[model samples]
Target: MPHCVILYTPNIEPKTDLGALCRKLADTMLTVRDEAGKQVFPTGGVRVLAYPAAHYAVADGKGDYAFVYLNVRMGAGRSAAVQKAAGDRLMEVAKEHFAPIFEQAPIGITLQIDESPGQVYDGKHSSLHPLFNK
Candidate 1:
C-alpha cells in the first residue's frame, strides 16, 4: 500500500490544483514496477490526499510564501533505486503542478518516501488486494 499525502499552504490553493496533483500522483504510483516488470504497488492500495495548511511559516515568517510537502508511505521491501525512481517521478509531477506558483512567489516543494519496517508494520487490506488481483 502506498499513501500519498500532500500538505500545502492555503495561499497556494488559488494558483495550484491539489485535486489534479493527487490524481497525477496516484497515476504515477500505479506505474511503478520492479525489475521483473511486475507492479510494485497494488492498484487498489493507492490513496492520495491533500490538506491545506491554514497557519504556517516558511522562512522566518515572511510574506507571500507557499509550501508543498509530499509524504509517501508504503510497505517495506523495495530497493533504494526503485524508491528513488518513484520519488523522482512524483517530484516531476509536483514541479509541473506548481510551476505557476513557483514563478509568482516563494514556493518550497519537498517530497519524502517512508517505508515502514515489516516487523512493526501490520496491515489488513484483504478486500482491495483481491479486487486488484494482487
Candidate 2:
C-alpha cells in the first residue's frame, strides 16, 4: 500500500483544498508505470490523506507560516528507481496543488518515502482494484 499522508499547517487551509489535493496525489501515483506501461502501483493500494497541524514553527518562527510534509508509506519490495519515480511524481503533484497558496504566503514543502517490510505490513482488499481496472 502506498499511503500518502500530507501534514500541513492550519493557516493554509483557507486557500488549500486538502480533499482535492489528496485525490490529485492518488491520481498522480497511478501514472507511475513499468516498462510495459502497466501501473507500477496498484489502484486499490492508493490512499491519500491530509492532516492539519495546530502548532508549528517554520524557519525562525516569523510571520504567518505554512508547511506541507508528505510521507508516502509502502510495502518494501520495489526497486530504488521505482521508489524515486513515485516520490518525484508525488512531489510534482503536491507542488502543483499548493502553487496558488505559495504565491500568496510563506510556505514550505517536504516529501519522504517510507517503507515497511511485507512481513510486518499486512492487509487485504477484494474490491477496489476491479473498479479501477474497468
Highest TM-score among the candidates is held by which one?
1
What lDDT tens digits, residue by residue, belong to model 1 across residues 15-131?
A: 867898999999999999987787877898899999998788888775887889999997888889888988999999999988887778999999999998856646574677678
| Quality of model 2 by C-alpha lDDT | 0.85
Clashes of each: 0, 0
In candidate 2, which residue pairs get closer than 3 Å at backbone N, Cα or C atoms, i.e. clash?
Answer: none
Question: What are the lDDT figures for the candidates, one per model?
Answer: 0.87, 0.85
Measured by lDDT, the strongest candidate is 1
Which residue runs of candidate 1 sit more than 4 Å off their true CA positions? 118-121
Minimum summed lDDT over a 10-residue window in model 1 is located at 118-127
